[model samples]
Target: MSNTGLMIFDGEVLRSIDISLPELQHNITGAQLLEISESKVSKSLSGLTLPPNLKNAAVSQVSDGDDVTFRRTEFNQQQASEKLGVFISAVADTLRDAPVVVSVLDGSMLKMFLEDEDDFAMLAENLFTDLDEEDKGKLCKREIRNALVHMGVDMGVPPLSEFPILDDIIKKHDADGDEELGQAQFAQLLQPVLQEIADVLHEKPVTIVQNVEIFTGSRLRKILADEKTLKCLVTKTILELSNEKDSQGRADPIKTLILSNGKELGLPPLSSENEPVALLYETIFSQLNNRDKQTAADASTEDGLMDSLKDILRKFEDLLETAPVYSATNI
Candidate 1:
């Protein structure tokens, strides 16, 4: 087993950083070394030079009883960067929201959709619409099995004689236990498969910061705890940054308008210099109620900030996706 520790700042540990021997060897940059060295020797500290090996070295100390051994080893920066990129990609992929599929009917609808057959379409068009309310409430086991068969055949899954899984699926959705699956039950049975397909078709990868709900909620919680930071972030976003233009000469009018309106409504101004734009938005979101938060988030999506965020996220995703395939030898 290897011992690991975090690189801490201001007494708070940043999450997901690994400072194990291997990691430290891989991530030690020239800038980091310069920073450490400069911080140590108060005045100028110019004319100092580092060993060539130090550029690729990992610094660590191991203690045994009263004895301590310091170790240093060389590692390639290209290799390290690739590994870090891969790690980031994995984390980004995990943060993505699962895809959503519209449910047509029970799990049977999934089979019909996958097969793209006329029979399934006919059944879908007539089944519930033709049946009376009472009749539409339940579908017999035979009907479910037929739908399952249609689904299984297309997917190369053989139908079992007992169809135990089918029975369980129906039972799970058969809320009334009338030995039949109602429309709602049918929809429930198909949800998982439909959702999987939906995810594949309409997948949108997002990081934790890009996830509106988590980003907003977490920032709000933090701001609420620290009123000073909250005020600073709010003032910067609404009063200053909103009017600032990007390289393309476009302003964030939606954010500007929203923040200005918020201030007009007697909302307090929070002041801070050089705060990050993301943090500013997070503070703004934190002040909103759930409904308002959602509304503001939705509005941001339409006003181009969402696209910018997505573009940034995609760049990271692309870097991570390609990292594993990158070769240090090529560099």
Candidate 2:
């Protein structure tokens, strides 16, 4: 895993980063700071650094929503430099507190195996043996696709769905045909196919997001730790719920509010309809006293609403830390 993807974050490394304008440049804008901060962080997470796609996504996710401090469009030279420092420090602090896990497939591992004669020979021999199941010294060339599947992500071979170029590579070599090949012939056919994939990957790496639930309660904890952010979220949800009332004139349930905003608060999204997630919410809601439920339902003032939201969020923080929930699909 370490060899296949850039490790997520190194707090010490991130904290030590010094952000500034290029030599002779005096000023910077919010957008430029964002670019510099992202570049520095990406560089620090070297080796298997985040591909452009993931890096851009992460930057947008972090800055666009609740963390709006980085969105200021302009600043004088001194202010820009100071704000840049502050933004980088905040990024370091947040990630150090709860780092997001990610993986990248850059095809370097395949290149390594292809470059080493002995390693490539052994890899070919092993693959041939695996595909040859019956001790028949020959295998149909079409088995090349299966061989790539067997190599999988760890070996730097992307899935057919992820990299359609592989299918083209196979057809180009006529390896998808029914022609049979012996061990040496198989090696000959595989070498060029792998080389082509490595070249393609060098140009365009894929960032893979595992679809596993995060049970760390990190997002919930972060929001809970910041009273201002938590209050803002509660206020925002309340307004949204009010605007989203049904034709019957009934406001959405507090539970619905929780479900709708789950992902932001470190729980699973409501759209998953995952049974375990539904059950978890049911358990939490069911256990709340009738008076507590009534209070949450009837609350109209900001303080009352905030208290109810805090209680519910605290429950989520505890339960999510104990159980996994559905997350976004892996890509």
Candidate 3:
């Protein structure tokens, strides 16, 4: 503290940083200003020396979610560390009355907290503000928004004072949902991901065995590759799930169950489960609503045929009531 002496107000560095002759008396706890001149102090202020460990401290405290991507490159990580060190050093060097503090943190904890979403999102929002206007668009906005949403917006993006736009965006997106979730929209969201997963399976052939609703391994791969149909179904499932009476109450769990059940409820199981029964109900109801369409096309042929199919579906439903898992062959 003595290297560059200054008179501070009430021991706060920022309150009064005067480089004139020392003004208070009876303070022997710290360094004495002695006879230092204003010119010498001004020269030292221009120099702005910081503690050597400043960068290390800043690097240690760096949050993981700002897309810093420490694993991306040694150079990038080290550079960030150094730049942060400079900032910390600058603060430490200037603020004589500041109390220095640091905490020991685990890499695992750092990684987990970073991914906790809501917490990271708040951090990203701050990071967003710190970035240049152009830089804000690329890394900050998307990641922060995603993190904010993924956390379920429980408190509605804490530090709400920051992102005024998020509330409106969420409301708008919710309000604008299609009457039913669109298959095309669903396909677009997952198609690329499924394709990537499928590419890995080409090397080792495997079956796309359906497990309830989960598509394990090779099936998952296949679904990713040729998922135009499944994606559409998934989208519709989501839409219906949204419309479900319980939708607003427990969204995540309900959505998860809806998707899991839908993924397994293919053409084979439709005859048994309410999923198919429900679809049939809709189809039958629509047909009943449009007597002209029923009579116009193939009422003499298709109408009775549809009745027989409905009876067959009823029998399948009876069989399905007793089992946890059922297959088409068993039905």
> Every model's Cα RMSD, please?
21.1, 10.1, 29.5
lDDT of 3: 0.33
Maximum-TM-score candidate: 2
Clashing pairs in 1: 106-186, 106-187, 107-190, 231-270, 231-271, 232-270, 232-271
Model 1, range 224-287, lDDT digits (tens) per residue? 3554543444455444544565625644434454455433322223334323333444543444
The residue-by-residue lDDT of candidate 2 on 66-155, one tens digit each, is 346656566676665565666566656655554545557787999899989999999999999999999999999999889999998778
Instruction: Please report, as a residue range, the 10-residue window in candidate 1 with the lowest summed lDDT.
Output: 1-10
lDDT of 1 at 57: 28
lDDT of 3 by residue, 1-331 (tens): 1111211211133223333333434322101111122223323333222233432332334323222443233333334334333333344443332222211111222233344657544544554444324542333222333434433222222223333443554343342233322323332322232232223323322221111221113232333344455445445544655577873453432224223554443223344354644554355335444555544233223333333333333433443332222223421
List TM-score per model, in order. 0.19, 0.44, 0.15
RMSD of 2: 10.1
Candidate lDDT values, in order: 0.34, 0.70, 0.33
- 76 Cα displacement, candidate 3 (Å): 69
Cα lDDT, model 1, residue 230? 38
Q: After superposition, which runs of candidate 2 have C-alpha atoms over 4 Å from their true positions?
A: 1-8, 23-29, 47-72, 99-122, 125-146, 158-184, 195-331
* Clash number by candidate, in order: 7, 1, 3
- Candidate number achieving the greatest lDDT relative to the actual structure: 2
Best-to-worst TM-score order: 2, 1, 3
Quickly count the clashes in candidate 2.
1
